[model samples]
Target: MKRNFLLLLIFVLVVIAISEGIGFQSIPIGKFNIGLLPLVFAIIITMVLGIRIFRKGIIKKIYSKENVNFASKYLIFIMLPLMARYGADVAPKLKEILSIGWVFLIQEVGNLGTVVLGLPIALLIGLRREAIGATLGIGREGELAYISEKYTLESPEGRGVLSLYIIGTLFGAIFFSIFAPVLLDLGFRVEALAMASGVGSGSMMTAASSTLVARMPELGETIRAYASASQLLTSFLGTFTMVFLAAPLQKFMYGLFIRGEK
Candidate 1:
């Protein structure tokens, strides 16, 4: 154990303290507003501090293996309360979600859009077989597990998924927080966007819906309920998409990308 655990704790406290101090600011440009949330800055600042460009120093010691692993291990536990609160939002609007229940299920097929849309981009950018893992449904926990088990982490596919997973972990929330509000400003419907926010990831859903709530406080509970329900369905359906849809699409595209098959 480190001699001064409080130093790390105090550093995080100060970062959050300063982040909250800035709060949420909306910058105006023409007719649209650019929103800045404190959590956005907090994430950026923490990521910058943890960057290994410094190599060895107090930053390295502060972000020790023990400390980092502890945070990683307990992140799910920390989100439990937030998930419970979102669950409450869903209960009141259960009937609304039920009305569109078929829409959500049908949209589960849309998960294959990942392979459809991204495989070509990945190949055009000069990725090899690694494109199989990278474009196979957002590179989240389930995709990683499936890739690792089917292909093993020692393979190139494993490396591809891991690389995308790390990137998603770092910036997905930031992108969602900004992207959701911008889309609404561009005249998208809140309910549709809320349902789409549930793109199979809890943190991303929360980030997107929070912006929606900030912009439309009157519909905050409804947004949360829609987002929470969508996220549950996306997560549940993603596995089937991966096995049935993603695999075949990847095979066909890989042949086109690598084998020049007609």
Candidate 2:
């Protein structure tokens, strides 16, 4: 166990070192600037290295299923407390969110637009139940929990949500990082973007806020605070939307459009 932790720590340090070395590189696209961070680069490096090592069959036991599982569990154990602390940090900021007035409410509603947009697209693409499930869900752990509980893990809906969850987990952050800055260049306010970033996923929020902060460092704390507050709002209300609104809306759309049912 100690050896595994030591290895993990070493890997973390290496990634951080590599990230810091190359973190300052930024790309200018027209009037918009895109920034990169060591954290993002570190993640990419770790993935590449892990794949190479795996393919080479080097240190196979270190990458064994049991070890991987243990590491995953350990990460969750560490993460949960941190997440709780983050929630607490954001709690005082709830009044700030409310102070934003109707904009905050509208943004919160817009956060669930995925379900609104996704269901029709899924039906148009000729997706059935499971695919619809995946498409309508926002591809997060909370959505996964709801889908799994309501539909069971082995159901088509479960499979759909799970597929989305995996895809979102892997790519959502990168997508946010790349696009948020571009959107800002396109004339969106940082506060609006920050609220948008909160769409019920911590990673996505982090990526989006990071991009904004990188581009506009002066507003870093404010951007993060708004984003975090928006995320907390989403976390609390997203479940209700999914259970009461999104689910039914998806079913109604699917049945009406695809199944041609009255």
Candidate 3:
């Protein structure tokens, strides 16, 4: 386990080194600036290395099964301090966040939009029990924890959430990197986009805010503060929103769908 941890740390450090070396870059498309942060590169590089193309070759040794399990167990600890830092981003914008207090609180109800809209689509696509997990939310850390606690990680619901969790982790940041800029291009306010960028996932928030900052350098600090503040609120509220609202609502919808099919 010690050796596996060391290997994981070494690989992470190497990736960080490479990303910092590349720094930040962007492209101009008329009024829009497509920012390219080192984050996108690191995700691509890490994913490419872990792909099946290298599975039977060199990376097999680098990402041994033991090391994979070891790393997963400790990944939470690694994210703890980083989440705190994200929360700290709210300090400078404390007044702003307080003024928009009702917005943050009301927006939490929107979290259930995933399950409300996704359940029927999921069922139509032949997803049964799994629909409960996948549609509960974006399947981030909060949903994963909720599903695992209520149904255990080995349950059908657990598989549903885990599937989305993996997909979100891998591609959500990239999606936000592109999506935020597109929204900005479409004439959305930077402040609005920044708040929306807080999808309750740290990586995705960073990607979304980075792109906005890189494009509108004058609003960089404001963008970060708004994004981090929104993220902090959503993440904190997302869990309760899930347990109290999404869960019961999913049950009702799933029951309704089952009856209709019958």
Quantify all predictions' global Cα lDDT against the true fold: 0.84, 0.73, 0.85
Candidate 3 — which residues are off by over 4 angstroms? 27-33, 56-58, 260-262
Candidate 3 structure quality by residue, lDDT tens digits, 206-242: 8999989988999887898888887888888888888
**Count of backbone clashes, every candidate in sequence:** 0, 0, 0
- Candidate 1 C-alpha lDDT tens digits along 1-262: 5543565677788889988999877777777776667778888888988888853676776788877776777888978887787778889999989998998887777788878899999989988878888999888889999999989877988998988888898999899888888888899999988998988877788888887888889999899999988887787888888888888888887897788632
Model 1 Cα displacement at 232 (Å)? 1.0
| The candidate that achieves the highest lDDT relative to the unseen native structure | 3
What candidate 2 gets wrong by more than 4 Å, as runs, is 1-5, 50-54, 59-62, 80-96, 260-262
- Which TM-score value belongs to model 3? 0.90
TM-score for model 1? 0.91
**TM-scores, one per candidate:** 0.91, 0.86, 0.90
lDDT digits (tens) for residues 1-262 of candidate 2: 7676566567677678878888755789788777665656766665666574463443444555666777766766755764575576566666776777577666656645776788777767766777655866677877788777878879888888888886786677777888888899999999889888888877777778888988889987778778877777788877787778777877777777765543
